[model samples]
Target: MIQAAAAILKKEITQELRTKYALNTILAFTGATLLLILFTLRAHQMDPTPKSGLVWIIILFASMTGMTRSFVQEAEKKTWAFLQLHANATEVYLGKLIYNFLFLLLLHVFTFFFYLIMMDMAIQSHLYFMSAIIFGAASLASVTTLTSAMIAQADRKGALFSVLCIPLVVPLLLILTRVTRFALIEGAASGALNDLAALVGYCGVTITAGILLFDYIWND
Candidate 1:
């Protein structure tokens, strides 16, 4: 099972890196998002308090643009059937989960730098911000993996993925946004630790759910 899963992940990651498509799309999307935010808010007197939830909401949707592509590409190529045939549905899901997580992780890191630069948001503490972003990214990954699987076969993949994913991700997004807000207003050490804990718990639960449900999705 481990070997089968590993092989699948390796294949997915190879395709992901070998093609300029996913990375380029994500980068362009992130850039456009950042530009829009900056443009819209530059003339207004914005709250000095960082609205962490708002930030994460943007991140989540931005990340989705790429998540939609992950499995949709396979569906387009008609290669998903080949994957399903070689591996158990569960294994295929695991492989996709791993690949999706890695992709989101990299996006979070890159976006963080751009966010700081463009948003001009002063970090109260880099450590807390880092921890919050990492946890938030993980949550995004887990939720996205399942949603992508759910919509993999849909004709309108993005629309379906968002409808299914956003509501489920609300609690995590709320906590993440609040935490970032606090970090902006109160600084890292002073931010609400409880929210961070919630983010952690949300990630754990979401990932587990994805893992367990993945087989059903793949087989369906």
Candidate 2:
């Protein structure tokens, strides 16, 4: 399983490096969204609540746009059948999950920096903020990866991806936004630990469920 996952991961990383399709699209969309927000709110001072909301909003949509390519590309290129011949469903899912998680972490980091720079948002607790980001990204990756696999053969993958992903990811986004808000406020650490725990639980559950169900989805 480990070797299979590693091989798949390497293949994915190499393909991504070669084409840069998902990476490029995510960066472009994120940049344009941030720029639009910057220009729209240039004169007004924005509060952290809405700023936090906006950050997750951008992440949600940007991730929806890029992460769907995980299995979609495979299906499009007819490589999914090749993978099924050589690899177990669990290995394929884990490999894709890892790739998506890493991709989302990088995307979030880049977007956060630009969001802070352009929107002038400040974090009071860097520790809590980074923790929220890590778990949040993981949760997003887990859910989207499974959903991508589930919808890979659908007629309208793009629309179905968003439709399926939104409800599944909403709970995670809510907890993440709350934790991030706590990270931003000076004295908002009261519930930070609890919220962080919730985020951790959410990530764990999503990944575990994906592991259990992915075989059925992939083979179906």
In order, candidate lDDTs are: 0.76, 0.89
In model 1, the runs with Cα more than 4 Å from the true position are 43-45, 188-191
For model 2, the stretches where C-alpha displacement exceeds 4 angstroms are 41-44
TM-score of 1: 0.88
Q: Please, what are the lDDT tens digits per residue for candidate 2 over residues 87-136?
A: 99999999999999999999999998888877766788888788878988
Against the correct fold, how does model 2 do in TM-score?
Answer: 0.96
Clashes of 1: 2
Mark the 10 consecutive residues where model 1 has the least summed lDDT. 43-52
* Backbone clashes in model 1, listed as residue pairs: 52-177, 53-177
Tens-place lDDT per residue, model 1, 1-220, is 8888799889888887798677888888887877777788662236655434455656787787788776787788999889878888778777777777778778877877777666566778665677777777778877887887778788878788889887987887778777777666567554477777887889899888887887777877
How many angstroms is residue 183 displaced in model 2 relative to the true structure, after the best TM-score fit?
A: 1.4
Using all chains and alpha carbons, the TM-scores for the candidates as numbered come to 0.88, 0.96
Model 2 lDDT, full chain set: 0.89
